[model samples]
Target: MNTDIEIVTGFLGSGKTSFINALVESTLVDNEKVLIIQCERGLREIQKTIIEDKRVKIKLYDAEKPLTEEYLKYALTLYRPHRVIIEHNGTRNLIETLNIFNSKALKKHCKITTIFYISEASVFNFYLDNMGGFLLPAVEYSNLILINNINEVGKEEIDKIHKKIDSINPYAIIIGVKKGESIKAMVQKEKILEEGFLKKLRIFFKNIVYR
Candidate 1:
């Protein structure tokens, strides 16, 4: 089976990890071997250890290593994962990674399922005010927008964020959710599965690693 690659993206402490925690929890009911590959700035061992499921595999990458195209190609080749989830570094350039995946070699192996951006409603203004820092190109590239932490930010703010996300990239699917929810549960499979199996997958991704 062609592995499904879903990229879940977001800013730091925006409940990206929390969202994944629940996602894998639900995934255990089905697939036993789910992989979560995380790229962050500091020691996130506690978070890494927390996602320790017999079914889930966690790979952590910190410290500066030359992030060349060959590095990613090798990782994709060796891992041979059923579902590959990447927790991207916010400051990291996503286009570079996307361009690498654009290769025919990768396209033949993994299918790009979805790109989900987890956003905290409270920081919508903060990110908007600091647009350049947020990487407009990456945001524009995402396929889905997940507005999380509705309790902290409130429904009104969520609505505003929706307006903001739509203004930025109208094509991305927008889903409003709490901080922690299962990956399979958050993505309403009914709507997407309607398109058929060849086009459906479940994965998590992120864009922000830190401040």
Candidate 2:
């Protein structure tokens, strides 16, 4: 069986980092190694926090200016991970990134099992309005849609958001694929429930810096 490669792709404040943090905490058993191929420069604060506290085995890479096909090829050849989960830079062309990943250099090393397009719950409607432009492009660009922060957005908004995303692509995985507030919750050593203005600012900075 081909090892699953879950690529989390999204725009700023879209919640890719949180989703991965959730997956890591849930799926990664003690000592079971997982590689996080981060397409960001230097150390991201949230990622660092997860490293400091979480007991799970992880390999984090900044990818310099941003890891390209060559960098991915290098990682695959060097790391040889059994299961690879890449968190794509939101600003990058993920379709093209996947295409490059399938290049002769790295195709044998990895096969994309699923692509999660992580985004904000509040912005779902706005994205849908631009379906022909941004929404459709993002939808067509991914295999699954993960609407985050369901707790804050509540069931009613979540339902509407699901309809909006599904209307664009009925074939896409809508609900179970939905990854929410778990990112921040999972990363915390103490598991704090507090999400304040600073939290929003953190997310905003993360999106812009990573964008």
Best candidate, lDDT: 1
lDDT of 1 by residue, 1-211 (tens): 3566666566776656665664554343333345676765332232554455565677776625424456555666776566677776665666766776777877776676767677766776568668744466556778876676667876677777777667778998877666565444665442532222332223221111110
Q: How well does candidate 2 score on lDDT at residue 104?
A: 67
TM-score for each prediction? 0.71, 0.65
lDDT of 1 at 123: 77
Question: What's the number of clashes in each of the models?
Answer: 10, 0
In the range 93-210, model 2's lDDT, one tens digit per residue, is 5666667766765666567766778777777776667644644656765666766665666778878777766677777765322342345344343332223465345434533543
Q: Report, for every candidate in turn, its global Cα lDDT versus the true structure.
A: 0.60, 0.60
Worst 10 residues of 2 by lDDT: 186-195
